[model samples]
Target: SKLFGHLSSNSSPLFIMPTGRTLTRTEFVKRLREVISSFGINSPLYSGHSLRIGAASTAAKAGLPIYLIKILGRWSSEAYRRYISVSSSTISNAFVLMSKI
Candidate 1:
C-alpha cells in the first residue's frame, strides 16, 4: 500500500515479528523497557505517551509547523499542542528570525 510516498506491504505488520502476531500493550512496554535498560537509561517513567510527546518535541525542534506535526502524529485535537517541548535556543532563534522581518 502507498501512504504519503511510503510503500508498505499489505500483509506485513508495521512492527515486524517472527511470530507474525501483533504485540499487546504489555509486550510492547516490556520490549521498550528492555531497550531502554540496555541503553543505560535508568528512568522507568517512559511509556507509549513518551514516544508521542518526544515525536512532537523533535518535530518542533526540527522547525516543522504545529499543523504538520499534528498531521504526522495523527493528532485529532488541539491537545497535541501540549506535547511540544520548545527549547530556549529555539525560542531565541525564532526571535532572531522574526527580527529580520
Candidate 2:
C-alpha cells in the first residue's frame, strides 16, 4: 500500500497486515520491535501503547486545551492524564513564566 495518499474504505487498508485484518498484539509488538531495532533504540519501554501516549502528550505540548485533548483522544474520564506527558522544556518554560508573574 502507498504510504501517502488519500484513503477510503474502498482503498487499501490504512495499515496492512499480512493477514489483512486488525493486527494482533503479538504482531504489533513484533513490528514495533523491528522498527525500534532499525532505529538503534535501546529502550525496552516502547510499544503500541506508546503511540496513544505520544499523541496525547504531543497535543498537550502543542497547547491544545485539556478538554479538547480528552475529546480528541476519546478519553471519557480523568484517566486521560495517564496518557499525556509533559516535557522538561515545558516545565522550565512554566517556571520562567511563573517567576515573572
Candidate 3:
C-alpha cells in the first residue's frame, strides 16, 4: 500500500526491511522506546516524536541553513520555524564571531 510504496523508495536503511514488512507507527515507537531503554535513559521527554524534533534542532544548532533543514525535515517554513528554537548559546556564539571579524 501507500506506506509500503513510501518505504520502498526511502534511502535510509533505518526505514527499509529485507523481509518486505513495513514498519508501522506503533512499531517504530516501540523500537525507539527499546533503544532509549537500552541506553538507560529514563527521561520521560524522550519519545518517537522527540527523535524528529531533536534531529531538526541539532541541524539548526549546527548552523545548517534554515532552508536546507526545512527540506531535510520535510517541513514547511512555518512548521520548521515553530520547531527550531535556537539556543541562547547559539546567539552568543554568533555575537562572539562577529566581534572577532
Candidate with the greatest lDDT versus the true structure: 1
Q: Who is ahead in TM-score, 1 or 3?
A: 1
**Model 1 Cα displacement at 52 (Å)?**
0.9
RMSD of each: 3.7, 5.1, 5.6
TM-score of 2: 0.64
lDDT of 3 by residue, 6-101 (tens): 534554445545787777777777787788888888745566668778878888888888776766676655676666778898889889999998
Q: What is the lDDT of candidate 2?
A: 0.74
Question: What is the lDDT of every predicted structure here?
Answer: 0.77, 0.74, 0.72
Clashing pairs in 2: none
When 2 and 3 are scored with lDDT, the better candidate is 2
In the range 1-101, model 2's lDDT, one tens digit per residue, is: 43323331234334566677877677777888888988899636788778778878898888889987776666668987988887798899999999999
Runs of candidate 1 exceeding 4 Å displacement: 1-13
Off by over 4 Å in 3: 1-14, 95-101
Rank by TM-score (best first)? 1, 3, 2
Residue 96 of model 2, lDDT score:
100
Clashing pairs in 3: none
